[model samples]
Target chain A: MKLIIFPPIPSILVSLFVFLALRHFLELRERAPRLNWLLKYLWVLALPLLLVVRITGSRWDTGVFWQIDAVYVVLMVALAGVVLIRLRALQPARTLLVALAPFALYALAKVPDVFLDNLMVFSFGNPADIYWLFSIAWLVGGTLVAYKQQTLLQQQRLEHELEARIKARNQELEQLVEERTASLVRQAGELRETLEELRVTQNQLVQSEKMASLGELTAGIAHEIQNPLNFVTNFADVSTELLGELREEQQRGQEADPELEAELLTDLEQNLTKITHHGHRAASIVRGMLEHSRASTGERLPTDLNQLADEYLRLAYHGLRAKNKSFNATLDTDLAPDLPLVEAVGPDVGRVLLNLFTNAFYAVQQRREQQPGPDYTPTVRVRTRLLPGGSVQISVRDNGTGIPEAVRQKIFQPFFTTKPTGQGTGLGLSLSYDIITKGHNGTLSFVTEEGQGTEFIIELPLSARNSPAPTPGGPAVNPAPQTERSSG
Target chain B: MNILVVDDELDVRALFEQRFRREIRGGQLRFAFAHSGEEALDYLHEHASEVVLILSDINMPGMSGLELLGHIRQEYAAPPPPAPPQVMMLTAYGDDDSRRQALELGASDFLTKPVDFVALKQKLLQLAAHDDAPPL
Candidate 1:
């Protein structure tokens, strides 16, 4: 039987086209086993085989066919070896291609004698059909295996993509959680700061309240003792005078009984000295108490209003803080630098400022509790400025619960208080009023708004009937005569 | 010279009598006790001619020494005697308010008590000497 070979030009052109196709699909992307090995690779083998046989002319007698077959076998074996070494990835389809390439080359060299005779004569007959069945079964089985492997690779790729997406999602969730936690931490920090402020305020308030109650107790004790003290001092002097008379009688020799008079005089002298000593002691003690009970208005001197206001503002803020543990407020002060020192009782002015500041803080703190929010900031501000008139205006202002209209008129009356029992003496504003207006000849007034806050304004004259410069180690003496007013 | 001692305390009268016993015996100084300002005024009216000095406490039960000082200034100090009975006010408080008020009310002098009896005696002697000399 004769073998049919395709012409060289057309076969070569077809082979070149198939080679470019293989380069485009098989060379670019390593597809699944079905396409890479079972289908596309067959084109690689079949086309190469066709070229080898066509170049060799399918005539082994020329000896050129044998030479070309040998060369082709060498090239195929070398290509297979290089591919096998480079493809260490261990894919079943690629591994099979490398393994079969040399065998395919050798079979193409002998296809005319060995494969063509059976295909031409014994092809399509009943006997050949049996052979085709075996080949079909093998092809079907290989196709099945290739398809299964391809399906598995696709499944693996989908699983890999799902895993990546899940990892990305997890990282995003973790970042969100971290941000939330940080915000919570920051909020907690603010709360801690607020709590710390409250604690400081409470400590200061309690301390001031204790001092105030103690002062009240001291004043009460001093008042109670003053009357008895007067008697002791008076009687002691009277008794001493009696002793003097006895001495005078002895000097004049007027006693009817000398020995009896001498005994009585000696006893009276001893008792009088003791009484005088104790009487002076009591008197001095009472004097000290009187000094502490209130400002000795007679001792008014030039005082720095700004410095005084600032000091008492801090003191009052701290004082309020001590009383109320959960109360806190921002304190701000602006005292004029150019304020000339005004004539005032320093302690009295201090007390006035303290009263005003305490009231301001209380108002703000009440407002804060009533309207609870981050926006609500409790605050007390103290400002001092030299007014156009011959006076310094000191104002203690607060953004707080201001005086209600109904009770405004009663604020300055003695025994009137808005604070709960034991919290206030009810005499603070009245006494403060007296101190400012009467003690220092200052105007004590207020500017307030209901449900907002209050600002107490105190205006003191710069020149308050100039007092005498203090004499060294002596009590304050009015160098000049002054008119008297009702010292409230 | 008759001196009126006006105070609320009962012990003050005995104390004054004991102290001025020598003076009283010598007839140089005479002390009369009056417990209240009103009583002192009553005594003053009765012995206005004899009394040479009035030492009165400012604070008292019925009438304050200040009120009594006003009475004495109006009734006694006006028709000045040859030796006008010097009115000295005694007080427990040393503050200028009371002192000023006492002096304003025609008190001859102001003294804070637990009185210095030595000073009081000296003041008394000075007042007597001044009265003898002439009215200022």
Candidate 2:
């Protein structure tokens, strides 16, 4: 068998470099598994063929030796081309070019030997030196490729770690926001509960104050009605006796005197008149009391302000008198003669007037006790006037110690009072103010001179009868123009 | 027997006068009227010795019947004019507080209006009998 001459070391070294670079490049790539596997195993076949060509030196046929050499070179070059194309996207251009260096050197070394016939043109340089240089070049190229692959692997690992840390931090931040939102919702629920509790407590206080005022009026009402009732029964009894006497005289037949009969008849007639008058008085008082106490219908009615003020003034005066018999106050009422009927809730307005009158009486009574003499005459005056604007104003004044400068600002506030704790409910002025302002769309204000007297004025619109009734705790139909005016 | 009727109502005077008209005409009983406690006091000062009984209403403008009873009790504590004036309290309210207070103040009796004149006459007759006066 004939062998062909071939430089075996360069061929082997080039094969080794391509093999190492191809293996790493395939490892880096993760797609086209069947193709990558076939390309990588082809090196096993090419390495053996290369060693066989080098051992059989020119003893083989020339065509067969060259064909073996050409086949292995073609296989290795095909492997490098495939690897370069696959790793093009994954690796830098410089690293890919270095990977191809040994293949190019192999091709250069063989080309000269193949074209020139028996031309040992470079016989001056030993073939061993050329093999060593090519081997060293291949070793350096393989090392560089290996180093680049290691760097790319470490970079990929670091990127994966950074992505994992970011995901974990995002989850933690979501949990923190969720916890804060839940806490805020819980606090809002607690605040709503507290507000409801306070509203209930305020409602209870308002109810209790109403009951207290009713209690204060009961004694006076009883006394006022009882006086007329006494007269009613007594006159009836006396009339019965007179009738009996007159009948006895008439039954005496011819002895009965006409003058005595006529006198008895006259007495009977007088007694009946007295009885009727007292009965009417008692009934009127009861009717007034019932009207004041009935539940509010929340409807506007045409009401005579003069009569309402007069009735409440008398009621309040009698109530104070019933409590202490020695307590005296002169009541002066100046009612407008042609005052237009006011559009108001009758019972609600009555209550406000009663409260104001009661407070006035109390103030005067207090001042009377403090500075008593014939000189200081306690008096409460009520004056009703028709303003030019379609409204009416009622003023309640007292000759008594007025409100202090410091406490006047809080006079209409609920649960604020100058009276001894048990004596006053403190809700009187506040409720009265609300009734006049919110219930009737009227203004309730006061003017006071410290130590002299205080006058509370209530101005109610007369033409608001057709307007919608004010709903409880809702905005008034027309806000009072003077609502913001502070009273002193 | 001279009796003083004290009340705040003006109509009480006419009612009492008519009720005891026969007795007044027959001279068996005499009725004097005063409008209030202060007027009653003035009347008592003038006719303290002649007054045999005082009927005063408990609820009045100036002074109450209980207070008047207290005043009378102090004034006629150890008196000797036929007899110390007996005070009867009259009130519209038939409450325990007023009754108890009237009694505590040495009131001779407590009456609620409209007073039963029949019962009142019987009581007055009983007192008149004790005083050796003729009953109407």
Candidate 3:
């Protein structure tokens, strides 16, 4: 017996196991380049050769039995050559080892057989059985190792993709934050500029108020002065015409009646007297205007409160009338008969009184315009009283639109105004308050009912009555009578 | 011709009377005076048909010239007196606003003070001639 130790069935079974292991390794070819090429050649050359040699040797009996051993040695040499040449390019050393394990173990199992057969000494009980057993164990172990390596590679690929996405998201968030911060900084700069512009406008408004006051004074002065000046020129012109007529009569010689000449002379004399009177009246008005225009001397003098009130009241009324010729209001004054003089700056006090009177007139005028019914009459009342506490109280009241509740607190604040832009400087009441409370040691206050009326009161102590050298400021009675009107 | 003069100044009456002395004496023109707008309206109400012309001051104590003009235009618009008297406005303010308002309110003419007697006389004479002409 030639010992038939390499049974055909076992041979086919080991080859099949090797085929399945190598197929699994082929799927990981990209991960293990050198080992993948080695396994591919083993599948194509060694597996088929082993099958052909076993079939031929089994049929021919002893004729080609050495051919199987020859083909095995050749396949092993070819696999070793390929693995050695491409070894450096292979990645992940553990998976490469697992992929090449079956081939390497098979080659080792064949080493003793090749040496023993080449020496031609002893054919010891068929070493082919040990080789076949080694083949089955290595193939099964290699397949399991290859499957484990494939799972690890897939997990690593997933982790790398997730890390890249996280980095890109972080970069996007940082860029958004930067853009928002820049926009906020730009808006802050714009707000700063707007505040600066508002401050400049406020300053300009204050300056405009002074100009407005001067303009009002000039208009009032011009209108008041024009009336007397008109009389002066007209009288002078008439007198001249009268003289020409008288000369023409004399030229008529005997035809001229004596009665006509006397009448002409008498008229001429009367006209001259009238001219002088008007001229004097114009001069007095000019004097008062000059005093008004002069800068206040700030010199305190014993001033009659009643006289001061009356003068400012007229001045304020005329000033308003000069701007709007259609404006009219009744003036009611109740001046105290026994009021004593007080030491105060005349122009300063006059300025305070003018501000109060102008405000009262403006309020009434506004109301009258809104309510044009026949029953609505615009009235401003001024009263002076000697209080028992040795102080003089002056109140100016108006039947007009009163101060609204919202603005009452800020009424005397600087740069606060109820009037429209360009009409008021917002300094009138503030300056008046300063002149009364701070300058004269007096109190100025007001009471108001919205949509109805307002009353401003000013109280001054009478301790200055004993001050010597009282300068008597000229005070005149109200020129226009107040009575029930058919239309007001 | 009958004319009414209105002004707040009391001396305006004397000045106008003396200035038109020749015409007044010859009975060519008769003049009446009122010291304020109220007085002028009262006079106008009493002698409704007598006044051929009216001269009024704009700035006055009781009623303004514009207000008086409005009242006159509304109250005396009837044709009984052939035509409503022509109104001439006199103002110390020669501002265009007042002049425009006066014209809009039916004032026939506007004058700024001090009154120019020479120009005034010419205007009065022309008006008198226009009035004296026979109706077409």
Top-lDDT structure, candidate number? 2
Winner on TM-score between 1 and 2 is 2
Q: For model 1, what TM-score does chain A reach?
A: 0.37
- The candidate scoring highest on DockQ is 3
Cα miss at A32, model 3 (Å)? 85
- The 10 consecutive residues of candidate 1 chain A with the worst lDDT sum are A479-488
lDDT of each: 0.62, 0.75, 0.72
Candidate 1 residues lying further than 4 Å off, grouped into runs, are A1-117, A120-236, A249-488, B1-136
Query: What ranges in model 3 sit over 4 Å off?
Result: A1-212, A246-290, A301-315, A321-344, A372-377, A381-395, A437-447, A457-463, A466-488, B78-82, B129-136
- Candidate order by TM-score, decreasing, is 2, 3, 1
The segments of candidate 2 whose C-alpha lies over 4 angstroms from its true place after superposition are A1-199, A252-270, A284-295, A299-307, A337-343, A386-388, A463-488, B1-136
Ranked candidates, highest lDDT first: 2, 3, 1
Model 1: DockQ vs. true structure:
0.11
Tens digit of lDDT per residue, candidate 1, span A1-488?
A: 32223222333344446335433423424533433343335455656665766775775433344444434444544444444444435353454454344444443544444323332333455443444445445545644564565467667878999999999999999999999999999999999998899768744653454357335335334433454465466556555665665576678765455764775576566556545654665564455334434434557678888766764554455445434433556667788999887877776677667678778877888897899865776878889898887778998888888877777777877558989998796667876776666566666777777776777788787776642232354312112211212111
Q: Per-residue lDDT for A282-396 in model 2, tens only?
A: 8877877776666567888889889889877877877887786667766788999999898888878888998999999888888888997767878899999999877899999
- Candidate 2 clashing pairs? A2-A59, A2-A60, A3-A57, A3-A58, A3-A59, A3-A60, A4-A58
